[model samples]
Target: MNLLPAYVLLDLETTGATPARDRITEIALIRYENGEEVARWQTLVNPHMPIPPFIQTLTGIGDDMVQAAPDFESVAPRLYQYLDGAVLVAHNVRFDHGFLKHEFQRIGIILRQKVLCSVKLSRLLYPQHRSHGLDAVIQRHQIVVAARHRAMGDVEAVAAFIEAAGRELGEDRVALEVARLMTAPSLPPGLDPSLLDELPETAGVYLFFGADDAPLYIGKGVNLRSRVLAHFSGKTTDMAQAVRRVEWLETVGEFSALLLESHLIKTRQPLHNSLQRRQRQLCAWRLAAAPDIHPQAQLVREDAIDPTALGDLFGLYRSRKHAEEALRGIARNHALNPRLLGLESGDVRASSEPDAQHYLRLKLALAAQRLKDWPYPGKIAVREYDATSQRTQLHVFEHWCYLASVDNEADLHDVLAQRSTPVFDLDIYKLLQQVLLPPAKTGAKPAIGGLEIVHFQDGYDQQKTSSSSQ
Candidate 1:
C-alpha cells in the first residue's frame, strides 16, 4: 500500500466563536486522494438563533437570508463519511479544528484523525516569511481571493497554497512533508484514528454512528471537521460503549439545519433524539367573553391563540388541566368565588341574597388580576427559529388564539388570505397569552409591527401537508 493518505481542505463560517452556544452558518470542503481531486461539497445553514449584528456583517450571512436553509442535524452523515479516511488541511488549523471538535463532542461523538495546518506548513517551508495567515499566504503566493472569509473561498485558498507548495518544493519533498503531516493525533482507542483531522469545518450537521452503522447521536457546527475531532479530547466518558462511524451534512445556513433537525427527529425518531422530538402540548387562558368585554377565564389550545389580540388572555399552559389549575390558584389567591368566575355551571346568586356580599368581595378581589383586553385591532404571527433544523416557523395568532404555523412567504400569504375560520386550540391560546403579556412593570409591546390583514384562501393548509419534508 502506498500509505500516502488522502487530504481534505476545509473551511467554515460560523455565527460566533463559541461552538457550544453559537452556530454554523456556512461550510466548504475539497477532498484530494493521492494528490488528485476526489470531491467537493459546500452549503449555507441557518443557525436558528439570531446572529449578532457584527457577525452578520462579517460573514455576510444573516437571518432573513438563511431563513429557508436546512438545519445541521439533517446533513451530518454524509460529511462525516467524507472525512472518515482523510487528512484535514486548513489555514489557521487549530481554531478551525478546535471549533469542530467542540461541536461534535456536544452531540456525543468522538473523532480522531491526522490534521495538517497550512499555516504551519507555510511557516515550516518558508521560515524567512514573518506571517503565516491565510491573507499573508494568499498575498505571498498571488492566489486570487474570492469570497474571502466565507467557507468556500477559504477552502480554495488552502488548495491553492498546497499547489504552490508542491510546485516550489518538488513533488518528493512535498509528498514526504504531507506524509509527516498525516501522522494521526492521540485519541481514545475506539475512535477512528482516521477521523479527527479530516472533517471539514463547514456549515452543516454531523452524526456519530456506533458499531454496525447505528447512529449514536447527531450534531451541527460551522466547522464539521474540527468539531468531529474535539470529541476525542479524552473527556467523553459517556460515549465509550457505542461510537464507530462518523457522518455529516454540509448545509447552506443554520436555519436550514435547525428546521431539518426538528423534522428529522420527528421523521427518523432516532433512538438518541427521542427526548428532543417529544412535542410539548401548548395551551392558553382565554376569557370566555371577547376582548373589550368583561374578562372571564377559559382554557384554549395554543393554535387557537390570536397573535394580534391577546388582551383578555393570561398564562400559557402545558395542558388545559394546567390552565384550569392556574386559574383556580389565581382565584384562591384573590378570594374570587369559583362559582361567580364560572369554574362551575350554576345560576348567579340574587343581588339580595345574604351571601351576595361574599361574591362581590370575591369578584372585586379577582378583578385586579383579570385578563386585559386585546391591544391590537387585528391578527398577526410571532416568529421562532429551529436552529438544528434551520427554519423560520411563524406561529399565527388571531384574537388571542394561535391559528397555525407558516413555513414560507407563500405559506404566510396563504394563511393571511384564507377566509376559513381557524379552529380553536387551547394550547395555542396559552402560548400567545404568555408571550404577548407585558412584564408586570414594563408591559408588553408588539413582537413585530404593522401586520396587514387581508382576505385569505388558506393555501397554507394544503402546503403544510408536504413542504414540511423539505
Candidate 2:
C-alpha cells in the first residue's frame, strides 16, 4: 500500500505563464516504482524565444544558458518514455501539466498522465496551515534544497515534502489522501480530455458547442480551465453532455472577459444562456426635457434611443411592457398620478396635484436609475494588460458604447476611421458605468482602480497617445 503504484515527481520552468503561447525552458522529474526511486531525468529546453528579464532573474535560466541546449521537439520522445504510465507529481501540477501538454502537442505527440498536485496534498494533510506554496512548505518542513526556482531543485523539494508527510502522518493516512486525490472526475464521452488540458488557466470566455456547431452555452471566467472542469466534476448536466466541442478566447483581465462574454451571449444567443439573450424590444424611459409637458416620461426603443442623450435615459427594460410596468411602479411608490404619467388615459385635471409638482415627483422617483453621462470629452481607451503573458487589450469607447477592442496601437486609427454611429447597448452601458464612473459618495474612490485611460481627442495620434498613456 504505497501512495500510488507509480508516480513521477516533476517540475518545469517556462518562459512565461501561458502554456499555449509560452515555451518550456527547463524540465525535471524523478520516477518512483512501488515507493522506491527508479529513474531521475532533467533537461534544459531551448524555447526558441527570448526569456523575459524577470524570468531570467527568477529561474537563472537565461537565453545564453539554453541557446546550446536541445529544443523541446528533440527531447519529447525520451521525456514521454520517462513519464509513461506514471502519475505526474508536482507543485501546482496544472501549470506543469499544461506546459507539457502544449509542448508535446507541438511535436505531434499527445502527453496524457494522471496528475497529483503536491500543493493539494499539503492542504489535505495539514488543514490548519494557511499556506501550501513551495516556499511555505519548505519553511514548514525544513526541507533542504540545492536550488529554489530551477526545475530540478523544485522537484527535489516537492519529493522531500511528500516523504516527510508520509513519516509524520503515517503511511496509511498519507496513502488515503493520495488515493482520494488520484481519483479524478470523469469527463463527458463526447469531449476530448486533451481539449481541457489545452485550456489556459487565465481570464477568458469559453463557448460550448453541441451538434451541427450550435452553441450550447457561453460563459466567462477568471480561470477558464478550472471553471470549465467544474462543470463536469460531480454530475454531468444534460447541457454538459450535449457539449461536443469547446472554444475559448483569452483576455488580459476579467474586465475584457466580462465584456466579451456579454457580447457573445447577446450575438450568438446560445441555447442554454437564455438569461443574456438579445432583447429585440429593448426600451428605456426617456424623460421629457420640455418644461410645460404634463406626463414627463416616455418609453424609447433601443434603435430610436440617442446615445448623446444618456443623461435623460432612466432604467433599461427588456420590452415596452416592462418599461411601462416599471414606470407605473415608480409613480405608485412616489405617490404620483399614473394618469398624469401616461400610464392611464384620463383628463389631466383629474389628478390631485399640479403639473409642476407631479413632474418633479416623477423625476425624483426615477433619479436613482438615471444613466450617467460619459465622463470623458471624447473617445477613450481602457487598456488592460496581463504581465505574465504580455498580452494587452485596448477597449475603445465613446458615450458609454463599446467601439472596438484592439490588441495594438497601430489598429486604433483604423477603428476610428471605420467608426460608425455608436449604437448604445444596455449591457455595455452598465459595464462601463461600473468600471469608469466615480463613486457616488464625495471623495470616494471608483469601483475599479488602476485603469489606464487614454484619451483620443481630435484623432488617434500614436505618439501623443503613447506619451499620454505613460
Candidate 3:
C-alpha cells in the first residue's frame, strides 16, 4: 500500500517481442530506500541470439559488445538481492516487470512485487498530452539522459520522471497514482520478486522451469532483457503461466542461439513450450523432382531432408502444413497442375494451356523469392567468445548443417575430419541457407582449392598450403 517504501527503479534490454522466443541482453536497477540511492547494479547477459540489425543499431549493443558478459544464472542472485522487498518502478513498467517475472519463473522462482508504471502515471496526470512514453516524458520535463535506449539511462529517466512529477503535480497526486499502478500481480508461490541491474546485452537463449526443475519454456533473442520481460508484461498469457524457475544459455552469435533454442525446446519439451513447433514437424521445400519432366511444379518435401544442407537447399518451412500451404498457393496462382505439383493427391499432368504457362511463370517468380542456395561449401566455422569464462569457441558446419562445435583449432579439425554427417534439421538448414547466401567475395584472394585447410591442435587453426593431391 505504501508506494514509496523501498522502491527499485528497473530497466531491461532484451532480444525481441515474444518472451518464449527471445532473451534478455542487459539489466540495470537502482534501489532507493527512504528516498535515497542505496545501491546500484548492472550486468550484460548473453541473450544467445543475433541482435536484429535494427535493434543493434538503435541500442548500440551488438554481438561484439556482449561477447564476454556472464549468463543470467551467474548474475541472478545479486540481482535478486537488490530488488528484494522493493516496489518496482519503470517508464513502461510492464516491459520491465514482465521480463523479471518470466526470467525468475524459469529458474524455479516465482516473483510478485508492487509495480508502478510511469507511463500510466504520466498519462493520468497529464491528461491533455497524447504521449506518455519515456522519450516523451523526458522531452516534457526537460530531463537530460546521458544515454538513450540503454538500460541504466532509461531507469534513471524513470527515476527523474517520478521526481519531477512529484514536484509539479503535488506529492499526494503522484503518491496516489503510484499506489494505483503498484498493484503486484499474482505469481506462483515459489518465485522471488526483485530488481536486477546491469544485465548484459548479448545474444543468447533463456529457459524457464517450474516445480522440481521441470522446464517450462525456452527462448532466444538478441537482447535477452527485453524479450524476457515481454512475457510478464501484459503480452501473452501462456508465457506468464507455467514458469517457476529462470535459467538461460549465453551464445556467441545469433546462429548459435537459434540452433541452441531449437534443440533445447525439443529436448526439454517445457510445458510452456509445448505449443511451440516440434522438431519432427519442422520442414523445408527442397527443389526435388517436379511431376512434369520439362515444366516442373515447385517440389515440396515428401519427407524430412537433412537440415545441415538446408543452406544448400531452399524454401525451409517449420512444418509440412506451412510448406504445403505455400506450394498450394503457388500452384493455384500459377495454374500449375495440383496433382503434378503434389499439392493434390492424384496423377501428375503437365498443363498445356496458355493459362498454365502463365501459372508456371508466376510459380517460378515465387520460387525465386523463396529459393536460397547453400552459402558455404564443405565446412565453415564462426567463433564465439565468453567474457566471464574467458574462452572462445568455434562452431563448425558443413553441407549447410552443423557437424560439431569445438573450442580449439584441433577440435575444429577433429570435428571436421571425424564428425559424422549431421542429421537433417529443417530449422538449421533454413538458418544456414539464410546465412550462407551470396558467398563471401574473394577478389584477389587465392582460389577455393588453393586455399589451405588449417587444423591447429593446441591453438588456433593455421591456413597452410593445399596438398598436391587436391
Best by TM-score: 2
- Once fitted onto the true fold, the runs of candidate 1 whose alpha carbons sit more than 4 angstroms away are 1-113, 118-133, 136-194, 208-216, 226-232, 237-240, 244-246, 290-295, 302-313, 320-470
**Candidate 1 structure lDDT:** 0.62
Query: What is candidate 3's lDDT per residue for 364-400, written digit by digit as tens?
Result: 6465645444444356665544442244566666665
Ranking by TM-score: 2, 3, 1
User: Model 1, 14-57: lDDT tens per residue?
Assistant: 88765656777787898878667779999887778998898788
**Comparing 2 and 3 by lDDT, which wins?**
2
User: Which regions of candidate 3 are displaced past 4 Å?
Assistant: 1-188, 194-203, 222-226, 234-239, 253-255, 274-276, 279-314, 318-322, 342-371, 386-391, 440-470
Please identify which of the two predictions, 1 or 3, would achieve the higher lDDT against the true structure: 3
Q: What C-alpha lDDT do the candidate models reach, one value each?
A: 0.62, 0.83, 0.65
Give the C-alpha miss distance for residue 418 in model 3, angstroms. Answer: 2.1
C-alpha root-mean-square deviation, each candidate: 14.2, 3.5, 12.4
Ordered list by lDDT, greatest first? 2, 3, 1
Clashes of 2: 0
